[model samples]
Target: MSDYEISNVDPNQELAEQGSDNFWLIAAIGLGLTTIGIGIKDFFTSRKLKQEREKNKLYQEVLKKHQAQINELKNEKERREYRDRLWAENSN
Candidate 1:
């Protein structure tokens, strides 16, 4: 018998052997890593949303205070003048 025979070589059999051995393990690890990444993404998204809500709440309170100050202005002219100044100051 010859040591190296081209007719005896089977590429499909070698591929099947390799695939059967590690396919499930590789698939499970990939799924686990994907799950972890999604969880981390969700956690950060929730944290950012909570921070935004808190910032909005603080902004609302400041806005109410400014409105009250503007309303207390005695005349329309003063109110409009102060309103313009307030907008410019806040925008900066």
Candidate 2:
């Protein structure tokens, strides 16, 4: 029998049997890897958002304390100025 001779008469059907199983196996592995990658990305994104929220809270607290100090200084300066004006007017 020659190497190219198949006992079956349908040439189109024999060609369809070549390497189709290998193609499907490779496609399934690729889909599994893509699913794992998306899961890992979501895990890291959630962690980063949590850290950013903590940092923002710390920054707000520091800003509030600085504003309080500024207001106290302004009030002290105004009191000093009023006292100086009163002393000068009473002496004249």
Candidate 3:
């Protein structure tokens, strides 16, 4: 047709340009995310470890406080007796 013949744009050129632009954009975004992840990877790992340790420390503290209460129970019951025995073994 006259329109196709008169047009300055080539169909292949337009397709190639679009594909190259999308590829570069995706590649750049992927590279940026990878770099950011690498840079902060250690920070997230250390923070997770720190949180775990704090959780363990709090758990131990709770047990220690509960043991003190169990030791104070004047009337011995099955539950109290069992807790006290476990406490005695772990205290040393």
Candidate 4:
């Protein structure tokens, strides 16, 4: 007979004596805590995203105003050049 031979002892006896340790209860508590942490992280992430979106909108509005001013300046310069050419042609 080898020392590693299988015995006829009940496998559940040791667990029963140790009160089974409520493994399912501990697992449920850990799962619930993990879910709450994920929810909190999601909430903060969405809030930051919203803030960034609003900032982008404001920047776009400012850029549009600047572009309009630049277009006005370009038009004025073209008008002056056209007027100068017409005056020179009439004098000649």
Best by lDDT: 1
The alpha-carbon RMSD values of the candidates against the true structure, listed in the order shown, are 12.6, 4.6, 12.1, 7.0
Candidate-wise lDDT, in order: 0.92, 0.91, 0.90, 0.91
Global lDDT for candidate 1? 0.92
- The residue-by-residue lDDT of candidate 4 on 1-92, one tens digit each, is 65455476678888986665667777889999999999999999999999999999999999999999999999999999999999999999
Candidate 1 regions exceeding 4 Å error are 1-18, 75-92
lDDT of 3 at 58: 100
Worst 10 residues of 2 by lDDT: 2-11
TM-score head-to-head 3 vs 4, winner: 4
Ranking by TM-score: 4, 2, 1, 3
Candidate 1, residues 1-92: lDDT per residue as tens digits? 57578678887998999898799889999999999999999999999999999999999999999998887765777879899999999999
Candidate numbers, best lDDT first, in rank order = 1, 4, 2, 3
Range of the 10 consecutive residues with the lowest summed lDDT in candidate 4: 1-10
Clashing pairs in 3: none
In Å, residue 69's CA in model 2 sits off its true spot by 0.8
The list of candidate 4 runs beyond 4 A from truth reads: 1-21
> Which one wins by lDDT: 1 or 4?
1
Task: Encode model 3's per-residue lDDT on 1-92: one tens digit a residue.
Answer: 58868596676987999999999999999999999998799789999999999999999999999998887674467678889999999998
